[model samples]
Each structure stands twice: as C-alpha cells, then as structure tokens.
Target: MLYPPHQPLQAAAIPPQRGPAGPAREDESGPWHTEAVCRRDEAGLFFAPSKEPTAARLSREEAAKRVCARCPVVIECREHALLQPEPYGVWGGLTAAERRVVLARRRRREMELKKAASAPRIAAAG
Candidate 1:
C-alpha cells in the first residue's frame, strides 16, 4: 500500500477548531482589579460624560475621586491603593489627594478612640 505523501505536514497544516466567543463569569480567585475597558483621552484620563460636561472638565486628580462613587470594587481598590500608596491616577476610585485626606481622617479617628479608651473613670461616693 502506497503511503500518503507528507501526511505529517498535512496534519500540521490543518487549523485547530475553536468555539464561539462568549462572556466569562466573574472570577472570584482572579485578581480584583477592574478591567481597563473605558476609553481614555490623550492624557490617559477617562472620557468625560456628555451630560455632566462641567464635572467632566474636572482635573484628573478630582475625576479619580469621583470614580469611587460608582465603582462596585471600591473596597478592594481602596485596599490595594493603601498598600501601594500610588502617587497618581485613580485606584479603588480615589484620587491621590482623596486618599491622603482619607488616611488623615482615619488617623484622627484612631487617636480620638485611643484617648477615650484610656481616660480614667470617676468613682461614685459610697
């Protein structure tokens, strides 16, 4: 029996079959960062909303803080932001300035709580 010519090469030339593309479910084990699907301008800032043109015109620093208002992963983003202490851009939907403000407030609250916990209680006269 005559063997097929270049049978191995013919098999290699055939393309692998592929299934139709579909949306993937949210991955619980995967990284918590949001996907960068929004359109950005030349400065790497997200495109402004047409309805809120005034708000859209805000500086990159302010715009980032606004992102947290609507973001679903704000908590995770804030945790990552605190760990990394990123200098610029939006992380967990907060701007660099906003993060600094939040940290300061947190420290202030902690100090107040500590002071209250350590205060001596007055004894009632028998």
Candidate 2:
C-alpha cells in the first residue's frame, strides 16, 4: 500500500520544514543553527517517519526542499548538513542520497588538489 488506509491525507501534506523551534537551546546556539530559515518551519517535513513508503518519502523530501530553495540561510544550512554528514532526511535542499553524491565529488576534488599540491614538492625533492 502506498500509505496506510488509516493515515489521514493531511499527514502527507507538505509543511514548512525547519530546525528545532523556539529560543535557541544552549546546545544549538551555533551561528548556523541560529541563522537557519527553517527554524520557523515545521521540523517534521524534513524527516521521514519509520516505514514511510518510497514514493511518499520522495514526495515529502521534494516538498521539504521547496522550502529550502526559498531560504535565506540555505548556504549555511547546506554546509552544516554536509559537515554533519547527516545520514537521513532532507536538509538544505538535498536528500541524503544527493548529499552522498556531493560528498563524493567533494572528496574527489580534494584528493586531486592534494595530489597536485604534493606533485610540485615531490619533483623539487627529486
């Protein structure tokens, strides 16, 4: 079943996705945390509940990203999500899988840069 029959239609509706709400908790006071545009949105949209179907989850994630696309602090949010290596849900306009692709590309670029940097030194030493 795409969704449990008992689940209300509203349950699948897209809501504004955000970070932890209310006054910045002591532990969440980092600059990115405070600056997040999602802070004012509902936190649930970004996360998939256990057992969510693949189709539903994809729809939900896209909805959450719509909010991210309009956010002012999207760059900070993306950086935080990438650095945290968040393993689930949608954050900063990208899903977990998309983040993986980006991370892989970034790693490849970093390795190439490192190799380039070392080549000059290696040649000098030889």
Candidate number achieving the greatest TM-score relative to the actual structure? 2
Residue ranges of candidate 2 with Cα displaced over 4 Å = 1-30, 120-126
- TM-score attained by model 1: 0.51
lDDT of each: 0.49, 0.65
TM-score of every candidate relative to the true structure:
0.51, 0.66
Q: Please, what are the lDDT tens digits per residue for candidate 1 over residues 2-72?
A: 11111243332343222122222237643333232111213245323344465454675366456555655
lDDT of 1 at 46: 34
Best by lDDT: 2
Per residue, candidate 2 scores C-alpha lDDT tens digits across 14-124 of 333343332222345433444455556666778889999999988888888987888766775676568767777777788889999999999999999998988755355
lDDT, model 1: 0.49
Candidate 1: segments with Cα more than 4 A from true spot: 1-29, 34-43, 46-70, 124-126
